[model samples]
Target: MSATLYYFDGRGKAEIVRLAMAAAKVPFTQVDIKEKQQFETLRAEGKLIFGQLPMVEYEGNHLVQSCSIARYFASKGNFLGSNEQERLKVDILFEGTRDFNTAFMPYGFLGFKEVLDNAKNTAMPRYLPIYNFILSRNGSNGHLVGSKLSLADLGLLEVILTIEELLGEDELKPYPEVQNFLKVMKSNEGLASYLRSDLRRRKNDERYVAEVKGVLY
Candidate 1:
């Protein structure tokens, strides 16, 4: 089946889907809409569902929403879960990470000192402990669901990376399980290669960061 992903040039909401597909060794095309006008054009043309990005076309099926896309690719790659119970567990953590993303996005985009401080003081304290507890409950195995890696782990890895970026690499020291979890996910050869690749590095450009800050601030 042919697969293509549409998102902004940066690694915002779409990173999880890309990571899942890459980890599963699924070859897919990534179309980066680098400008606001391009996105507006696509939306105006009714080419994007839900009037937003991070959409995917797989086997001729168009999917909207980032988490939905990630879950679909995860299922396709056999990284979702083995059974109903495991799937439920994976969904719980995945949704939790989504919630964390929703809460933390403003901090990243706003790019204000106060916003960063608020996230570090309020959001991180409130959310990180919950994730830490979940990881601990799962035997601190670096996998949020079951004994093996799943979509939940990939989602959490994204969350952890974002937190580290916003705060610092040392911020996760308070949550050792989460730190370990990040390490394990990053150690995956496919994921590591993708992380080190030009596609990932180019997303960190100053222009994109400035654009996000300009729009939100």
Candidate 2:
């Protein structure tokens, strides 16, 4: 394949691309930078689109930004939708997941308690109901947007898992439709295989958030 992903080999921001590729069975070169020396070399490279990680090099063109990469692969795999209306719905739901990640980043990734406290008190309560409403309204077929699997579905599952893993499981208990949606996504053959793959097993550890999971409401 001509596609190549250059990232630190973590699930933090690159896993969505990995997930999209896996779901579509599209193979690419996974260039992982783990050594500090290599990281420094790549970081000093001036050709980066935005001077950041998660940059995708495809067919000799380097694309920066995570969502752009996701959308590109989603389109390549025909995971967007069949029509413009459905495509807009896909965009809406995908943006919702992005909002969730941004809202929870300070708490989940940066360990910022002020932000985490506000998220638990305000953002969580607000978005939980909104997501549940979206799921109830559009996910009647147990899908996030349309009546089939799409990148939006994958994004929603990622947000749900991030919440359950980073915030707490109880965080999604009130959103039954979302919970059900995640269950389906988790059971997807490609997604399940990737989640259980040795690459994932060796890279992720849930123990870091054990204490947060215990205290999440």
Candidate 3:
């Protein structure tokens, strides 16, 4: 299938799908609608969406919503789960990540100081313990649910990285398992390469080393 990821030129919600595509070794086109003029054209044509971004145009079908697109590409790459139970586990992780993302939203898009203060005071303290509990229930420190990698792990990594970015690398210091999990995932070759790739740098501008790397594992 010819897969095209359509989004703003920069990395936004659609970033996970891009990382997933690269990690899966699935060749796809990156459609960057950077210019406002082009954005207006797409928006007027009902192509660019209000509630979604980084949407995927797959063989004439436009897939809206970031998580849905992630799952679509993940399924294509066999990254969702190997079974039903695992799939549910993946759902939990994704939702948890979404929750974490939601918690962080109050602080995001604002200046770094406002974002950091909110995160440190409200977001981090609230979410971190819940995440720690999830890890405790799973089996060990690193794995969130199954003995192996799941989409949830990727989601967790994504949130954790966000925390790290906001609060600095030691943001995850309180959760050793999460830190260890991130470390291991980053070592995965496919994921590692994607994080280090020019595309990621171009999109994020800042160096991103956590969740994108975890997805490939």
TM-score of each: 0.86, 0.80, 0.80
lDDT against the true structure, each candidate: 0.77, 0.71, 0.67
RMSD of each: 2.8, 5.9, 6.5
**Candidate 3, 1-217: lDDT as tens digits:** 6677766555657667766676566667776655555555655768656634567777687787888777777777677777898888788777878777765543324544665676688767887888777777776647676776656766677677666765677777887767777786687676777778766634242222232233212
How accurate locally is residue 200 in candidate 2, as Cα lDDT from 0 to 100?
48
Where model 3 places Cα greater than 4 Å from the true spot, the runs are 44-52, 105-108, 201-217
The segments of candidate 1 whose C-alpha lies over 4 angstroms from its true place after superposition are: 201-206, 209-217
Alpha-carbon shift of residue 108 in model 1 (angstroms): 5.1
lDDT of 1 by residue, 121-167 (tens): 77788888988898898896688888888988888888788777767
Q: For residues 82-194, what per-residue lDDT tens digits would candidate 2 score against the true structure?
A: 89999998988888877776765444345556656777787678777877887788746778677888888878777677678766788788889878888888888878887
Error of 2 at 16 (Å): 2.2
Which residue pairs clash in candidate 3? none
lDDT of 3 at 54: 62
